[model samples]
Target: MIRALALTLTLAPAGMAGAFELGFPVDCTLGETCFIQNYFDHDTGPGMQDFTCGPLTYDGHDGTDIRLPTTAWMEAGVAIHPVAPGRVKGLRDGMPDIAKDDPAAPALNGRDCGNGVVIDHGGGWETQYCHMKFGTVTVKAGDQVGRKTVLGKIGLSGNTVFPHLHLAVRKNGVEVDPFTPDAPTTCSAAPDPTTDLWEDPIPYDSFGFLDAGITDAAPDYAAVKAGLPPRLEFAPDTPALVIWAFFFGAKAGDVLTLRLKGPEETVVDQAVTIDRTQAQAMQFTGRKLRGSWPLGDYVGTLILTRDGVALEQRTLSATVK
Candidate 1:
């Protein structure tokens, strides 16, 4: 069951986070690409539900949020485009894209969507692009746009944390899930939508593995977000080594396993089972060693599985002097 309320948390996937890996609405760069920060909330009432009854969504969230990993990318400028051909119907721009903790963010009022663009595809198909960077919108209120037309750059405008494009789709003005185009979420009794816009929407077993790294210490967001990450190399005098892996979704009874192998064939293995369904990441810190250590290459491998089936696996490596 969804909690009575959604307390503000870090970024999250709104839906199942699936894709055909083709024809993205934004210029997708490796490590700089966007993930589904939120999927549309299919539960239009008291209980919460995504199309699959998954935890990847919140109550009332009505769009597929493609989110950037950091604010730096927002400033660097990422392009936003339309998935299908359409013409501009409405738009707004110029609101500052600030952090959720910023004091000036709350003043946006109904303009919280910040700089945005709207395109109306023919035949009951209309799309809304929200959180565009200021001064970057290339189209006007009544301009025509192609499937690949550059609408604007992604930004932190609107009610958002990281940089992203909240692509809200509608049919005749009522909200709809872009992922499941054929089946209306309101008809919960129907099967999952078979029609999809993506050419290949199947996600890999470990698709949720967003980022992984080895650190000199138990990592924090600041350290993880550091421009020069703590992985790849470490000094000989380093006190302790910590390994972390970030993933998207997990439910009770799912198992997460981690293993570390040293140059001399030393191995460290640890495992944890999720206690509930939620969006989160996990960390594992190796024992702090004092003596000068014999180190060359160290590897950390993570696998997430349930019911004897592997859902995902990831590996990280670091070197010491």
Candidate 2:
């Protein structure tokens, strides 16, 4: 059973002069069945068992299993919306989901970060929504969103034991406990010189930020259509490589294909079918491709299409040595 936070705490004063008021990512009603897992202290330690990924065993109690009521809604399309106004900063798409039994899976992984979006609310403060349904993200990098803007739907796409929004507020680029009383005080008292900034986003409900309203706009198909073919740029490193890709003109329910080719045109192909209803990123490791390649030159191409019609394509080259 998930523990619920008591509803009687005073809202933390918005930190940093110019810090934006953040919103809740879901339409959580008072007394509704919504709970935050791993809100603070996510890393493993005493009393902190990993809940994101599984092999979950806690004193003979399987931890991954959520103790649900006899009638629980485990349906897959809960909408994930922006909690505050911000600009889209980063996104990833075309990554594969980690296997349920993969022992190496983190409580969160690139794929479990399925179709994610990062929104920067200024002052170096950002919010990230992960494990979203494929292709449902309604915002893109560089686009601006208001408090009620729908971002995507919640799903178990990435490294998640259950469907829930993974949210955090960063100060100087590091995740800090928003609920900590001394967070704002500490951040306000002594500012970090290296980054020279501080941020604190009060978790929804913990304060009095409640569901105000929902914006019902037609799905942004133009933005969706613009993300069709995924584009990749690769830079080689001595033993490892850096690969980045941009996907555009894509929609929910579209199937995307990715291929990495080496000399002689040897191809390693992988495919990801997107749930266009959501706006998110798809990213993954080329572990299979890496296993087969010798340290040398390579090229990657990503193709997007639906119902046999070619949508878009992008290609890039890299060196592995």
Candidate 3:
């Protein structure tokens, strides 16, 4: 029951931009990717707002949730990096990376942030990295960290259904939108100030314009909400593979397409027209390949378009044997 509204783009005067610049916190290449799972919320009980005043965030969310596609990726050691140069301000560790289903997990509380590190960059700026893998906090309090410094490995050590690093940036103790630190608060003026945050900010579209990937099987968000891992990667000799793509801030009149191209052929191609706008929607298509299965790379692509304009297009690949 979502509806699209005409997009209104805004940019603050160049004179009002911030002096600070940041970097992305994770290291990814090629087949590996990262995306914003949740964004800093700007609204109260009625609705939600992300740094971009987009629907990528949830109500009450106070930080950016940068995420990997699977916990297996987290377990294999995806290092979490600091976005700015700073000195470690606080450090906490030793929380086991336990799933919520494990009764042994610590009672959710202040512990919800789990093993993490907070770095204070002078001039009243600070950044906090939460949900780090247990025992992977490499920097102790007062340690100096440079941009992209490896502080820890990402993990599910706290109150989260997914494995990610919850990055909270603050200015003099007040939460700030890294994307629009120069303009007024997003709660006040959205379309987030055009003032970019990163030294070379990766625009929202570059990373998320299309948040998509291949799953070991079909994901039922119902099960995902019930504490189940929604994604699984394609395994060697598996019976089948599911391709799911998620489009964010999709408006009416947009056409969504999901395609699966195997080693030798186009296995599945599905498309649906958005009758109304949606904050996010998952479109999935899968196949049980015949014979012994392909022995090379399988690619999945998702493309979204509106009135012949390409809004977002991305592709992910999985090597299978």
Best by TM-score: 1
Cα lDDT of candidate 3 equals 0.69
Per-structure clash totals for the candidates = 9, 34, 1
Which candidate ranks first by lDDT, i.e. highest?
A: 3
Per-residue lDDT tens digits of candidate 2, residues 1-321? 111221111223334433444455666532234434333432232343222221112221111111111011224356677667889898765433332344754454335456678888886667777766556777778999887788876544565544455665554555533433223212122223222121333222111100111111122322222222222323332333323333322456666676666675554566777664222234322432344346566776666676777665666665544
Q: Rank the candidates by lDDT, best first.
A: 3, 1, 2
Candidate 1: TM-score? 0.81
**Candidate 2 weakest lDDT stretch, 10 residues:** 206-215
lDDT string for model 1 (119-206, tens) is 8887666788888887898888889888679999998777765577888766665565655654434424333434444544523121
Candidate 3 C-alpha lDDT tens digits along 31-74: 24656767666554457766666566766666777776656677
lDDT of 1 at 135: 84
Clashes of 2: 34
Superposed model 3: Cα runs more than 4 Å off: 1-17, 29-32, 99-105, 187-194, 206-255, 260-268, 273-282, 286-301, 306-310, 314-321
> lDDT of each model, Cα atoms only?
0.66, 0.45, 0.69
Between prediction 2 and prediction 3, which has the larger TM-score? 3
- TM-score per candidate, in order? 0.81, 0.42, 0.69
Q: Is candidate 1 or candidate 3 better by lDDT?
A: 3
